[model samples]
Target: MPRWKTNLIVLWFGQFMATSGMSMIIPFLPSYIQELGITDPDEVAIWTSIVFAGNFLTAFLFQPLWGKLGDRYGRKIMILRSGFGMSIVVALMGFATNTWQLLILRLLNGTISGYIPASTSLVSTNTPREHIGFAMGIMQSGAVAGTILGPFIGGLLANFVPFQTIFFITGGLLCIASLLVLFLVKEKFDKKKAAKTPNISVLQGFQDLRKVPQIPALFSVTFIIQFSLLSVMPLMAIFVQGMHGNSEWLAFYVGLVSSITGFSNMIASPLLGKLSDRIGSEKILFIALLGAALTSFPQAFVNNVWQLLILRFFMGIFIGGLLPSVNSLLRKFIPEGMESRAYGFNTSALALGNMLGPITGGFISGFITIPGLFIMSSVLLTFNMLWVQKTLITRKR
Candidate 1:
C-alpha cells in the first residue's frame, strides 16, 4: 500500500477513537447536569446548550492559531497537541462538583479541540489529488462509525459504571489515539519553507483568502452545514426521553437513536463522495441540502422514537455527503501552500456554527418545543441551498 493510504488507515482509526471519546459523554449530559443539582426543566435545557456550546465558543477563537502553527510546525504535531490536551481536560470534567466547573472545563476542552480538523487537513494535503474525494469519504466514515458506536457503548457503560469513570475512560482513549498519530502518521514538512514563511496575522490570512472568488461562499456553506446539523444535538436526548416516557433504559434508547443516524451516515458518505468526484461536488451538496431539508421537516412531528430514528437515518444519508463535498470544494479552490490556513479558517467557521447552533436551539426551545428546533434547522438549510444556487449562478457571470 502507498504511504498516503497507510496514513489514511491509521488516521481513520485515530479519528474513530478521538470522535468516539469526545461524543461518549454527550448522550446523558442533561442527566449529568441534574446530578450536579440543577433540577429546573428550563435550567436543564439552558445548561445543556451552554455546556454543549462552550467548547466551540472557545474553539472559534483558537482554531486559526493552531492552523497557523500547523502551517509552520506540522499538522501532525497540532493533532497530537489537541488529542493529548483534550484527554487531560476531559478527564478533569469527571471531578467537577458544580455546573460552573463543568462549564469552564467544557470551554477549556474547546481551546484544545482540533484533532479531527487537523487530521482532515493532513489527509487532504497528503493524499493524491485524484483520490482525495474517496480518501475524504473514507476518513469521514471513520468519524461516522465512531459516532455510531460511541453513544451505544456509552449508554450501556453508564448503566454499569459511574459517569466519572466514563470520563476517565474517554480521556484514556484520546491519549491512545494521539499516541497512534505520533507513531504511525508521517508528514515530510519542508523545514526551509516553514522557517522562511513569515508569520501572518489571522485577520491578514482571512483577507488573503477573500481575494479568491469562491472562498467566502464556501466558508458560509461550512457555517450553515454545522449550524443546521448541530441545532438538534443538545435536544436529541431530551426529545428521546420524552418519546420513551419514564424508561429505565432511556440512555440506551437515546444512544440508539443518535447512533442510527451515524450508522446511515457511515454507509452513505463514501458512496456519495465517490459520486461527487465524478459529477461535481456542487451538485451533490445541493441535492444533499435539499434532501436533508425534506427529511428534517417531518422530524418535528414524530410521535415515537422509531419515527424519529427513521427520519434521522435518512437525513444522515443526505448530511453524510455534505462535509466531504464541502471539503473537496474547499481544497479545489484553496491556493497552494495555504491548505492549513484555509482549512483552519474553515474550521473556525465550523466552530462559530457549533457555538451558535446549540445556543440558538436552546433559546428557541425556551419559546417553542424541542421539536420546533428541527423545523428551524430544516428551514435554515433550505435557505442555504438557495443561497448556494444563487452563488453558483453569480460565479458563472
Candidate 2:
C-alpha cells in the first residue's frame, strides 16, 4: 500500500480514539460533578456549564500554537503530544475531589488538545492532492462515528462501573491511539528546508494567510457551518419532548434523534468526498450549503418527532459535505509550508463555533421559542450559503 494510504488508515483510527475519549466524558459529566459534592441543583447546572465550556475556551486559544509548532517540527509529533497529554489530564480528572479541580483539568486538557487538527494536517500534506477530499471525508466519518458511539458506550459503562473507571478507560484509549500513531504513521518532514523558511509569529501567519482571501472566507464558512449545526444541540432533547410529550422512553428517543444525523453523515462523508475530488470542493460546498439551508427551514415546522428525524437525517447528509469540502479547499488554497498553521486557525474557528453555538442557542431559545431556534439556524445557514456563493463560487466563475 502507498504511504499516504497507510497514514490515512492509521490516522482515521487515531481520530476515532481521540474523539471517543473526549466525548465519553459527556454522558457522566453532571453525575461526576455531583459526586464531587455539589448538591444544589442550580449549582450543579452552573458547574456543568462552566466545566463543559472550559475545554473549548482554551482549545480555541491554543490550537494555533500547536499548528505553528507542527509546521516548524512535524505534524506527527503534534498528534502524539495531544494524544498523550490529553490521556494524562483526562485520567487525572477521575481523581478530582471538587468541581474546581475537574474544571481546571478540563481546561488543561483543552490547552494541549490538537490530535484531530494535527492528524488532518498530516493527512492533507501527505496524501496526493487529488485524494485529499476522500481522505478528509474518511477522517470525518471516523470522528463522527466516535462521537455517535462515545455517549452510548459511556452511558452503558456508567451503569456497570464507577464513573471514575470510565475516565481511566478513556485515558487508556487515548494512550493506545497515540501509541498506534507513533508506531504506524510515517511522516516526511524536511527540517533543513523548514529551518530556511522565515519563521513568522502566529499573528503574522494569520495576516500572511489572509492575503489569500479564500483562507479567511473559508474559515468563516467553517465557523458558520459548526454554528448552524450545533446551535440546536443543547435544546434538541427539549424539542423532542415538545413533539413527543412525556414518555418513558424519552431518553431513548432523544439519543435516537441525536445519533441519526451522525449516522447519515458518516454514510455520506466519503461518498461526497469522492465526488468532490472528481468535480471540485467548491461546487460540493455550495450545493451542500443550499441543501442544508433548505432542510433546516422545514425542521421549524415539523409537527412530529418522525418528521424532525427525517429532516435531520437529510441535513446530516449535506453536513457531511461541508467540512470535508472546506478541508479540501484549504489544501488547494494554502501555501505549501503553511498547511498546519492554516488548519490550526481553521480549527480555532471551529472551536469558537462549538463554544458559542449552545450558549447562543440556549439564550435565543427563550426569546424565539424552541421551534423558532430552528428557523434561526435555517436563516444562518442560508446566509452562509450566500456568503460561499459570493466569495468562493462567484470568484471562481
List runs of model 2 lying over 4 Å from the truth. Answer: 27-47, 237-252, 301-306
Write the residue-wise lDDT of candidate 2 on 322-361 in tens digits. 9899999999999989989999999999888766776677
**lDDT value for model 1:** 0.85
Q: The CA-based lDDT of model 2 is what?
A: 0.83
- Candidate 1: misplaced stretches above 4 Å? 144-149, 393-397
Tens-digit lDDT string for candidate 1 (1-397): 8989988988888888777775676678888999999999889989988997888899889888888888888889989999999899989999999999999998999898887778888999898888888888888888766856688778878878988899899898888888888898998678678878778888888899899878889899989988987888778888888888867788888888877778888889889988988888888889999999999899999999999889988988998888788888888988876778888888889889988988898888868778888888899999989987887534645
Candidate 1 collision pairs: none
What local distance difference test score does each model get?
0.85, 0.83
* Local error of candidate 2 at residue 306 (angstroms): 4.2
TM-score of each: 0.96, 0.92
